[model samples]
Target: MKWSIVFLLISVQVFSQKIIWSDQQKLEWSNFKSKVKTMRNPDVVAYTHCGWEYSSTVSSDPSVPVKIKITTIFREDKSWKDPKRINDYALLHEQKHFDIAEIYARKLRKEVMEHIKTSSDYNKNFKIIYNRILNEYKDFQIAYDRDTQNGMNKEKQAQYNASIAEALETTK
Candidate 1:
């Protein structure tokens, strides 16, 4: 039996400098390694660049298990912050953004596993599912920022923090 392996790294933009997300690893001010040339918005304190990547292997032998790996990553070179305006609250907010990406990564893993079980053409199906989920993930990210007002509104931010934490717990 032969094994076919496929790998894909999808993101809004390509990045080489990245840190994989982990439960033990938390975001710190130092992680924002980029220096912003100009502030597009004066109110914006920081930006966290996070996304997901996946790879899968399929075995021709039905007895062999399929291998799918999904990873949530943060791009240090793409993320930046205003050091003067930084605070613990803002850092936590950025951490939650990374957590949100991890949540979506888990979602993608679940969908990929389900699709591969019955898919005759998993490669094509994987792209289709990935693209669909990617769109949703982007929209969700936008909504999160809008709802929390970029973590300015304490009440909304708290709500999102609780929601995101619950999601991570239940998904695990």
Candidate 2:
């Protein structure tokens, strides 16, 4: 018997060089490949673009199980830093942002697994969950920058760094 599989991918529209999040790999100054642009707020020294994407595959045969893959990615081409102002502290802050994206990607994977077991409408439910998680992830990123004062507040930056490290440990 020949079994068929259907694949569905959901992701942002950007087509750029991306690096998958990995525990063994950490972000470096070289990873920030985009040309630095003047921002409205001159205090902004760097930007890190990180996010998650997922794809689902369903087999035609009943015996074959459905599979879902979630990936956390760093957009190298879309991230940038001001060379004159960049430092280790600022790099740590940016790394935390990427770490947060990985945490959310794991959360989405868990949700998809649980959801697939219970929901009959996989695609619709998956989209809903994906959107909700994406929104939450974006909000958290904004809050991180705000609470840390864009890494200028050393104390808050340390707190966020610790929090993100703990989350990364527990989520995996």
Candidate 3:
């Protein structure tokens, strides 16, 4: 009986963590897709679900090109109700991802050449920098998560600011 109860509880929690993007998330993601269309000239899509925060590109067909997937956290909180703020957050963070992807699109050939010539440490450092960039973006996500729990709007905005600062510093 105890084991069954625990299983049910876990299942409830897992089901609760679902993607339910607000209209604001959709609008922001739509704008993001428009911008990326010009920048990447490829297919783009954004998905938001509770308890998950990430994005990627995938190729479903051999002849078809890769498509973008901007997955973000979908919290059941008041922050998402505020279209302006959440839109701002989504735009900023997803743009960073898009910008990084665009950089890779342009430099993949060069990076591959450099990766072949450089020491393992160089490749490791490159990965570290890439991770730093991602972390810089996630700083906003952390703030959003915290805000959703505490209703700290200012703190959430500050997270975006900090993320931008950290991203700039990492690039340098």
Candidate 4:
């Protein structure tokens, strides 16, 4: 008699530059140290790309605890800038974009914590919660860009900044 073990392979484009967000460690233009892209589209002088990595694990025993984590990542290589045109104001807008990512991470943590009790089908439930939070986060990010007109609208920018700050506190 013999036992068999199977492995699943998943291919993903992994970025080497991954910076986890922290309140004490504020993002700076220096942190945007990745090489800038040569194809500098005039409409898009600078970009701050962000995302998250979520994972969970379960033990063979049903009584074993399930572990889960959601990490907010800032892609330095993907996030580019045109120093010739990127100004302090533009940098603030980008920083705010990163802050928005942290906001969602905290919110996701809260949601996941609440559902930890029901770990019978952790993967399915986790996906539902993760996707919902991610969708909402994307929607808010787009709305921020549109409402502030990419930070050109000073009034709207202030409002968004204030709102994001407040949201950060609550999520914590």
**Top-TM-score candidate index:** 2
Error of 4 at 23 (Å): 0.9
Error of 3 at 155 (Å): 2.6
Better of 2 and 4 by lDDT: 2
Q: Write the per-residue lDDT of candidate 1 for residues 41-144, one digit (tens) a residue.
A: 67889999889876767666654556778899998988999989999999999999999999988888888877766334464577888888889889988998
TM-score of 3: 0.25
Task: Measure candidate 1: CA RMSD.
Answer: 7.0
Model 2: residue 96 alpha-carbon error in angstroms: 0.3
Task: Give the total clashing residue pairs for model 4.
Answer: 0
Residues 1-172, candidate 2, lDDT per residue (tens digit)? Answer: 1232222121332334788899999999898989956356788889998897777676555445567889999988889999999999899889999999999999999888887643244644878988899999999999998999899999999898889999999988
lDDT of candidate 4 over 1-172, digit per residue (tens): 1222222111122336657787877666755665767444466557888878877777666556688888888877678887788888888899899999999988888888888643464744778888899999999999998899888899999999999999988878
lDDT of candidate 1 vs native?
0.83
Model 4, C-alpha of 105: deviation from truth (Å) = 0.8
List ranges where model 2 is wrong by over 4 Å.
1-16, 36-39, 59-64, 118-120
Question: For residues 1-172, what per-residue lDDT tens digits would candidate 3 score against the true structure?
Answer: 9999999988975665333333233334433212111212122123222332333333343333332233334433212222333445544544443333323322332333343233443434445544554564456445544453222355654564476456444533
Estimate TM-scores for all models: 0.81, 0.83, 0.25, 0.82
The residue ranges of model 1 lying beyond 4 angstroms of the native Cα positions read 1-16, 37-39, 58-66
lDDT of 4 at 119: 49
Error of 2 at 97 (Å): 0.4
State the displacement of the C-alpha of residue 35, model 3, in Å, after optimal TM-score superposition. 19
Clashing residue pairs, candidate 1?
none
